[model samples]
Target: MATTAITRFAHEEIKPKIGSRILNSKEELLAGDLGPQIRELLEQSGVLVFPKIDFNDDEQIAFTKTLGTFAPEMQDGTNHKIHKITLDVKENPQSAEYLKGSLYWHIDGTMNDTPILASLLSCKVKATWGGNTGFCNTYAAYDALSDEQKAEYEKLRVIHSVWATVFYYEPEPSLAKIQGMQRIGENELPLVWNHKSGRKSLVLGCTAHRVLDVTPMRSAEILVGLREWATQEEFSYSHDWSVGDLVIWDNTGTMHRAEAYDPTCNRMMHRTKLQGEEPFE
Candidate 1:
């Protein structure tokens, strides 16, 4: 029988339950064939932070590909493998307006059955004040639930709508704007996602418009309560960025939101992703 090799990189836990810091050089991370180990770490830790690794666009893209399929970002009717994450219209014109939704807690690709597998963000410019990204480990949150709560939630379903997210920032949207966002569509997902790996996670987020077969008021209460519980200090991590820092989170098992900040303060991030491997089931 062959024995598996032990992982060699240095690591530090960011929190007891949710996050970790990878203490390895950019060169080693980019060159080492550590995808399996890294993916396992991501599943276990939920979030990984690389302090001041300073990877540029090409390097970031290369690093993303090392893990799995590279998910390209669509901009200006073109596919750009690396996306510039900024609220500045000059830098990311097409995506800037849509990014307002990032201010609220949400999972990416809620409109699709399968969201991106993971997101890798490298800091280009740190915010002048309050731009730390917040993440919550849904897996940890679900695991922390009481047996009765888990059993009850496991049977519920939710309606996740792209248009609903628009209302978070724009309470009263114009008919045309509503129609446009509606065209992007919505998906009905389980309140609890049962992963192929046998772990479970909550699928609640801002995009979760309502719980099906439940009263509107009840839906609101349930969703809001679950979100609050999941985001409590124990299961969440808020990253204070330093220029050149990189952060990665498992999109399938976590909810993330951008902390409020000055859009014009020139806070910038470069983002890359791994294509989704499992659909929400």
Candidate 2:
């Protein structure tokens, strides 16, 4: 049970012995410093894409529970209080319009009280070519900026909501529909977050609708610019999924999105999120 950031073994050795044997034999994954190292790595890098893991739903859920409370995907149910995505999302396009937003680069569940902390995604089906999941290291992006840029961002706070942007171009949103969004605004989160490791990161993305205490038009210009600046290729990594691969990212420090895939072919992936405590203080 090697630990303390041991390099993953060669895939030849790993890819072959990746069944219940490895799952049962591996202590580091179960109860060792590998857990903490993975935790630290996620906070440091904002993204962790291990090569592959032969994990079942029960095993995946079990592993995720080790980190913190699990946030199940929101399903569309009449009485469901929290957002729990229904099975029909991927099955039917008309019902999955909300998920279409995921095709664009954005943070997840930022409109809620606990802005989803971490996301654990398991790839069950692979697209022929496209469908890569892209992750932007906001921590790295913030650090690479000039001190002047950092200073400028520190003074900003953005408003977030679920539906305003979802229906942005719509001229006349129905009154009931607008109210149904359950839009909660006026959240004063910092644009620059200083992590415990002395690293700083940007926290801007699509859900961030407006700047607090700033003019609406200028705020849009600034936010659009910042998003463009932070997501440059050098600070980003794209994960092309193989069956059984699991990727995790710190939602507090990174933004992510799914690339366009041919929905005609079977494409199924399950995502579990960790609840965010504070938007990096």
Candidate 3:
């Protein structure tokens, strides 16, 4: 095992609001002292980009464990910890349709009682056209709101479901089609998540369906307004990935989406998730 002192590594802010780029080598990332620094930085900066880190499945899994507990159940059936992120039917026939939901803005595991803590994605093959991952800092968005707006939002709750996210890709999806897809059932989550760190983040995303105690139209209005507010350019970063680039984002405080790409572009990414320690309150 390698050990590198934290003082030796440097990181630069990628954007004023959301992202930080680690100015260190892949070997330094695997070092013992780096994970705590990375986790602390991740909490402050919503996303961290390790340009061209090129971590393999085993190396990615090892790094993930350093930050927090590895989510073993997040893996696909191949007995490997990495889940291949691609649109190719042959590579992921059973789950390709569900993966299309990634094209929309969402926090991972919204329907789960406890959503994922964080996600690590390493780009293996870059698409010819577009496959950039976009991240928005919901924490910043929430904090920027007027006190009155915050008060109103904090009183609200929203329902999340797999069907809501799937419908983002397929508008007017048939009931049968939605039932056929993987349904995690619906969960009612607070519109504003007050984390253990004493920070609050807006939990609005595509998976979010409607706000409680409001008419359907009013709920739609609130959800849409919050989504727009959270995803404004200043509070978000779009990462144009190169092969070997590895990125991790604080899933609890951010929403992410993949840019549109041709289905045949052969873009591939390997992903590993960190299990959540806190539930949405």
Which candidate ranks first by lDDT, i.e. highest? 1
Write down the lDDT of every candidate, Cα atoms only.
0.93, 0.65, 0.88
What is the clash count of model 1?
A: 0
Candidate 2 — worst ten consecutive residues by lDDT sum? 12-21
Relative to the unseen true structure, what is the C-alpha lDDT of residue 31 in candidate 3, on a scale of 0 to 100? 72
Please say which candidate is ahead in TM-score: 1 or 2. Answer: 1
TM-score of each: 0.96, 0.77, 0.94
Ranking by TM-score: 1, 3, 2
Which should have the higher lDDT, number 2 or number 3? 3
Backbone clash count, each prediction separately? 0, 7, 0
* Order of candidate numbers by lDDT, starting with the best: 1, 3, 2
lDDT of 2: 0.65
Best by TM-score: 1
Model 2 scores a TM of 0.77
lDDT for each residue of candidate 3 in 84-119, tens digit (9 for 90 to 100): 888898887766888898988889888787989999
Candidate 3 colliding pairs: none
- Candidate 2: count of backbone clashes, pairs at least 3 residues apart or interchain: 7
Determine the C-alpha RMSD for candidate 1 after optimal superposition of all C-alphas: 2.5
Off by over 4 Å in 2: 1-28, 31-33, 72-95, 167-179, 182-188, 196-198, 264-266, 277-280
